[model samples]
Target: MNILVISGGPRKHGRTAIAARFIERTYGFHTVDLSIVDMPMYTGEEDQSSNPFVKSLRQSVLDADAVLLLSPEYHSAMSGALKNTLDFLSSTQFLYKSVGLIAMAGGGKGGINCLNNMRTVMRGVYANAIPRQLVLDPSVFDYDRDGLNREAAEQVDGLVEELKMYARIAKEVKEQQLI
Candidate 1:
């Protein structure tokens, strides 16, 4: 499947980026690291469709068979950058698309809230977010800073498999509906 992983951390070398890179390297998935991209905050008052970054972001979502949102917990919620990026998109870009959620918690205890928040937004955009989500805490990196430990890697593997399965099922359903 053409999985698009969006790294929504503010820091380029943060935990979210590490997870994104690991997924890309292990699964050959495409990644959009938001920390390096200068995506203007979505104000809804301006038409950013013409903006190159916004256009690219929109196109990326449109081209993906599935999306994996990677975010770091911040004050019990997702980063503002991620929320703004999501605001630039609509149901047209995500409807029926399989989406996987992963949250990195700096405090080792706050990632679940971030995942919950992301799930709510995915619902609003009509994405078929898989039920198997992940919340990686500090413990996940205790054995490996650049990648997930053995246990966390297994969890991510399961989530990715579920995402791929759902993406295939959704694609088949859509094709059948057209016929």
Candidate 2:
């Protein structure tokens, strides 16, 4: 499946980015680091007709069978970059697509809030968020070597499995509708 892994942290080499890289290496999923993307703050009045970055970002979502959103909790919520990227998308872009959320916090205390917030936002865009989510603590991830500990690796495995299953179901339903 064409899964898009979005690294939502602004730091190019943060824990979130590391985790996203793990996913990319393991599953060969396409990874987009928001730090490198030239996405401007959504003002709701910008001309997207000529914006190559926006167009490319939108097309990435359109091409993906599922999306894995990785974020670092910032003040009990997702990073502003993640939220802004979502703001650029609409229901049509996300409808029926599977969304898996992974959130990281320093003490493992704030990721739940970020996951919950992301769930709500995904719902608003008509995406199906898998029930399984990964709440990561940096200590559990070997950021120095860019790997996950045993426990974190298991959780990621489950999340990826769930996302693929849901994506398959969504694709089947879409195909059925075309018949």
lDDT of each: 0.90, 0.89
Q: Any idea what lDDT model 1 has?
A: 0.90
Please write out the lDDT profile of model 1 over residues 4-45, one tens digit for every residue: 999999888788888888889889998999999988978786
lDDT of 2 at 97: 91
lDDT of 2 by residue, 134-157 (tens): 888877888667988888888899
- lDDT (0-100) at residue 92 of candidate 2? 74
Candidate 2 positional error at 178, Å: 1.2
Q: How do all models score by TM-score? A: 0.95, 0.95
Off by over 4 Å in 2: none
How many clashes in each structure? 0, 0
